[model samples]
Target: MVSAGVYLVVRIFPIVQASVVTMTVVAAVGAFTALITALVGLVMNDIKKVLAYSTMSQLGYMFLALGVAGYTAGVFHLINHAFFKACLFLGSGSVIMGCHHQQDMRRMGGLAKLMPITFVTFLIASLSLMGIPPFSGFWSKDEILGSAYAWGSEHGGAYWLLFLAGELVAFLTAAYMTRLLILTFAGKYRGNDAPTEDFVEDQAKLQSEQENWEIKKYDRSLGGLKTLYREDEEPEKHEEHRHVPRESPWVVGASLIVLALFGGFFGFVGAVPLGITWWQGFITFGHAHHAEVNWLVMGISTAMALGGVFVAYIIWGAKFAVFMRLYRTRLVQVLQAVLANRYYMDHFYNGIIVRGFMVLAKASRIFDTWVVDLIVNAFGAGTKMFAYAYAWFDLWVVDGLVNLAGYMWLGIKRGIRPLQSGYLQHYMLVLIIAAVLFWVVRYFF
Candidate 1:
């Protein structure tokens, strides 16, 4: 997934090819990333972290190749990287599991004898990644460096600097890879007390076996329940034990063996030095072109790789006491500190970029709470007030008018109600009164 960015940039090569500036930027970034990550890998203590940095460094190399318009070279390295890096990762896992989940190289050594298959497989993969000859990494990486140099020669100035950086990265990659292999599988074992889990598991198994044997040998009539012996006659204390590293199961070893074989010889598919062009033909994009192996570049790269291995062997393998003395120096300590801290890039991100984003997030929350919520609350209050006014008008003015009309009708009904009594005399009286009222009104006018 981390390499996806390089793949994406390569996928859009037409657009990238259109801009010289983009290509230069990609090359510059790749060279810088490759060198910096390799330096970081040099100081890493965890076996897996070393491999992680190695993957990044190798991805940087691929990007450098793509940036220089070496599409075939880039894709070739990508494929070769997959085989070797996967093997290295699997080999690391096998080591970790064999060491009872221990990953620190400082706590591991002399595992080659215990896990012979893993060591051989891991070494082959390491050699391939270091770009040693005959391995797939050597062919793929040599092509990338040659491409960088050729591109730079055509365009001088900072382009040359990029090529130089690529060379230096190759050197550092070998150094760190050799350092990892040595610390992990060379010298005397240093993790005698580190495998606590394995030790505990073995002790438990031993105790269980002892208890089961005792249960079968003794009769239950001699005691009660599962306890055939009295509490005072309990089992003796087990002796202390150290965990031993062992070879991984056949399933895992088989995968590593297969990948190691490819890592060792897969480069023959694109072995430019040997005039092999099958890989280039198969994975070409746009115009397929042949890559000629430059003897000078090949010689210098091989020397750098070997030189790196030699330096690492002296420092970590041959002269441990002398290296320890140098390691304790103030300058060396400071250099180690910088590399180990990844040149403080993590701190800058956390202190500045991350902090700035967090502050922005807090401000957004405040605005949402104060401004947005206030507007919504005010609108709600206004709507509620308008609803109350409408309720009051309906209850008082509108309903009162209707009630007044009803009362008036009721009063008139009451006034005329006595004339409608249920009697024949009452009806006759009402008719006589009506006639008298009519005569009186006519006489008085």
Candidate 2:
């Protein structure tokens, strides 16, 4: 998320500010991120994701600007980028909605004429991203690069790499922006619409168009158009045709047109070469250091940017045979694999980091289960053993003593059985005999 980068930008700098080490770290991270996201943007099929990565790449540039002490330049681009980028994204959304929610570039083509307002506005935003001549993006980008060049020239070590990366990202920005424009709006209609000569028969009737995106010509790679592929292909399952795309409604188109105006001319707020300086004035930098656009850096950066646009046009719009072969090579295949996987961030996060944590969690669960059960089972086993011992004592020692007493009493009763006769005479004779015996004993003593 942009918030994460913003966190880094806001928090980390104040710890060690206006120093070479800070600048080096910030510049390195920003350049690396810019390059990575730019590559990812090149291979993105979904219209919105390409723009999203572009947004991230632009932020990286802002960081780079800050690192080089061109604080005003960064803010300048940020303001210009925010306006144009919004218009681009919203316009893309309109096209996607117009195309029955088809977001892939491969699924879209030849809508420029149909959606004139959206296309023109979107193209303006693309030019801003491309950093083409006389646009606000050009001025802002020129300032950043000029700042980077100034830093490198001022310090001739590996600091030059910052300038190099800045230039490289500039070109890449142009390439991806051009590619998006050409692929989305230049070619023949490739979407779910049936192959028909008339793209739009009646404008008013198209408001009631179908809202489905039918699948067709996906894996075959018609005329070398790159596809978002699913391995399965079921022609019978798909709807035969989709609705034709028309211009966006007035509400969507109006904002895009207005935003396009801002993105187109907002750079005039800060003159590129010290003519007018709104953004440069606002920079919180050393008061003594003033940045003026270096003519040399400006020429080179502008050329590289425009060259990127030319190269993109040659590859996608011109459809040169050489570019197609290059794309089919093993190197490009490997590169696509990398970009498509988003430089393997997801794999590292989901596969390695997440899996590692899950393993730890499962091990802890196993340990907790066994250890707690052992402690609990120890008490249960001890209790059961004591119960068994008590049962044994009750059955043998205590019960035996009681039974033995009972038997002795029973034996004495049996020995005195004849004395307990029912006859009264017998009972009286025994009493008299016992009395005489006792009298005699007492006299003799």
Q: Which stretches of candidate 1 lie over 4 Å from their true place?
A: 193-240, 320-326, 351-367, 402-445
Rate residue 248 of model 1 by lDDT: 95
RMSD of each: 10.6, 9.5
Each candidate's clash count: 0, 0
Q: TM-score for all predictions?
A: 0.78, 0.74
lDDT of 2: 0.80
Best by lDDT: 1
Per-residue alpha-carbon lDDT of model 2 for 383-407, expressed as tens digits?
A: 9999999999998999999999999
Query: Each model's C-alpha lDDT?
Result: 0.86, 0.80
lDDT score, candidate 2, position 124: 88
Clashing pairs in 1: none
